[model samples]
Target: MAFKEFNCPSCGALLKLEYRFTETVICPFCQQSSHWTGENFEAKGEKVILADYGSKFSVGLQASFWGTKLGERKEYKFKVLGRVRFEYNDGFWDEWLLRVEGYEQNEYWLQEDEGEFFLFKKFDNLPSVNEYSELEVGMYVDWEDYKMFISEKAKAQISGGEGELPFRVIPGEQCDFVDGILLKEAIPVSIEYLPDNKKAFYVTIFNLDINDFVFTEKKQENVY
Candidate 1:
């Protein structure tokens, strides 16, 4: 985690990109969204600022967690690097990017929905389906020795974002999503089919409780 700094195209504010593969940067001063075009940054209009609901997680916060995943106990000390907010019919959820200490390339996604939290690792080997339309709810999918039952499906939009993200975030960009669960282990899996055939899958590694987290950073007023 090294970072590169850039000048905001809209307000001339400085933007530091913490994520190596960041494709978009939102100016903290002006809330202007800019897309990196390889050559330079281009304006994508002002993005909506996400409201803080006091969910106990925010960018730049340091925290630790002790949990067991897949029958192995582990402790993680990490920092909240960024967050992407998605809005669906049920409301919204925040996907926080965490940089885990003591590990190389150890970034993980922590999803917060309602009061439930799940830790996930990105799966590089995507499912065979090229399009979301090809899949339906209640279908059983067998992949990598696990039988997963499709539990939920929805179309969601990128409502807002904070800090740095690996990919471009276009506000109101919609994508089709599918959620599955390993029945025996109760492991949750998520799939997203985005525009331009880009897809991503996240395999849930841990089910977390609120008490599992210990804030390592001291709280400061107006930080969130």
Candidate 2:
């Protein structure tokens, strides 16, 4: 049988109409439960709770990082572009899709949970210097292999601890960027400073339970 396509009237989320005989389908994008009868479909506007699906990060959320190391500590910044849920032997894993504005043209995914952050294993290509040069403040930079870039302003804040940093300097607090994206609050559990205060900054990922986390949806104005 031929398949059909439908758009959500409430959120405009794409819905795939899979069968001529099938009369009902759930939207994979938005959690809104919908029913299809004949040529026209009705949006119930009821929230459907999935067994495994939960909160998800939107595309416009700004990616921010904190450094515990001293002396030109790298601070990699990026924006979330997509998110996917994966089920494995252990449990469910939420993979955040990121796009590095100036470093890489393609998208990368990162596992969002406690413990160690998992790298995107889908891509074979790496970021380049040319891409870095194109980066602007508030642009999304995935935390892949590229280390965080500590701005001179941030360095001054760390040295003196007197002035406020451009981004959130505190352990937790949602920070705003020029692009209108909001970043989640995170604290560095550990930091390793480099010698001469100008080389490297190693930081341990924040340990937090996934159940306690909340996801922010993408604003309608930001959708393209």
Candidate 3:
């Protein structure tokens, strides 16, 4: 990916956008968030979720994982692109947009709630989500070897978003998503199904340190 020289319209601070799959960016210096309007960057609003619902890993954080089923790469470094907060009736969760190194053609979303994690990769050829959108709990769905159980399902709205995102994800966009879990193994895995046309996705669990990816010394705000 290439870096594009630009300044945050909200703050006077100089910012650079990696011309990867992104449409919005937040200034690390001022916490000013803006949306990319294709031609120009327009100020959206100031990011507010930095304090409440803090994250272990901050946006702009860099990390690498080996043998990713999402990208089908053996090993690749990924940059934390953006963090979007979703609020349902029960509670809220955080979803992170990640950009693969050297590859801007695709983007991935890593959803995290508490210690539970789910990495979603969209596949067009996969079965339509509508076919099993109403899967009841206690029922199992086969995915290769593991039989994943429908854990929970609900609708959420994008409460807040900061940093660079894959597309225009402004506040107030409602999202319909579903979740599943596989308890067959000692370490249970999870799944998140989206109602998007070609947006069916699955997860691969991971646990990593925030210190390794975030520049905490320079940033005081929390972005999960």
Candidate 4:
């Protein structure tokens, strides 16, 4: 295990954190949220409580799952970080910030809605705002030679967050997106349009089956 220390640029508070691909943190002194830019931090905004606090899956829960990536067998230990609530139409969905381990990448997102659990990641190589702004719902895009379409094109907001994150997640950070769906698997594919093109994008998405996955609770251990 290794550790890293730095000063909060916002309040000059000594920011000591667990060093293992940490991208964002909230200062214990000023309570200001920041993004770790490799070596430095830029203040994003103040953090706020998410719109919905009670859910089946809360932040800081630990779970293990037999997930497949790149067509290989690997283990995944996920720690829930932040939970952002978005108001869409008369319904809503909670976006859980997950700090992932055992995977090649450091982090990803897990979302649970209705009776389905979704796994998603951000990918920036897609058609940009200007490129896809004119795109309408039900439009198809060639992806992996599989037919993908814009399913729900709407706006959302970062209702709140907890723990560390990699994006400027000031509560109420407006979000707009055009979601893609895979018809065969009824998969809610990845497609998030970051407001400032700052947060990461989504490229890969999967519908995790409970039978093929395992989950466990987090231990009462201090990561620090």
**The best candidate in terms of lDDT:** 1
**Alpha-carbon deviation at 55 in model 4, angstroms:** 2.8
Over 4 Å off, model 3: 29-32, 45-47, 52-54, 65-76, 102-105, 124-127, 131-148, 182-200, 205-224
Clashing pairs in 3: none
TM-score of 4: 0.71
Candidate 2 clashing pairs, residues 3+ apart or interchain = 74-148, 75-148, 75-149, 76-148, 77-141, 78-140, 78-141, 79-140, 102-131
Every model's TM-score: 0.89, 0.32, 0.65, 0.71
lDDT of 2 by residue, 1-224 (tens): 12567776557876554223333344456644455545665655354333433334443566544323354444446665434333333444454555544544543445555544533323222232213234455444334443343221111111110110111111111111111111232322111121222222223332324333333443335223
| Candidate 4 global lDDT | 0.63
Q: In lDDT terms, how accurate is model 1?
A: 0.79
lDDT for 50 in candidate 4 is 52
lDDT of 3 by residue, 85-104 (tens): 77789888787877767755
User: What is the Cα-based TM-score of model 2?
Assistant: 0.32
Per-residue lDDT value at 119 in model 1: 87
What's each prediction's clash count? 0, 9, 0, 6
lDDT of 1 by residue, 1-224 (tens): 45677898988987777766677777777877788899888878556798887778888788988888567878888887778888899988889988778753755789986677898877653756335776678988776787888888999988878877767788888866899887798889898776567888888877898788887665645435
The residue pairs that clash in candidate 4, if any, are 64-214, 121-202, 122-201, 122-202, 123-201, 123-202
Who wins the TM-score comparison? Answer: 1
Positional deviation of residue 141's Cα in model 3 after best superposition, in angstroms: 6.1
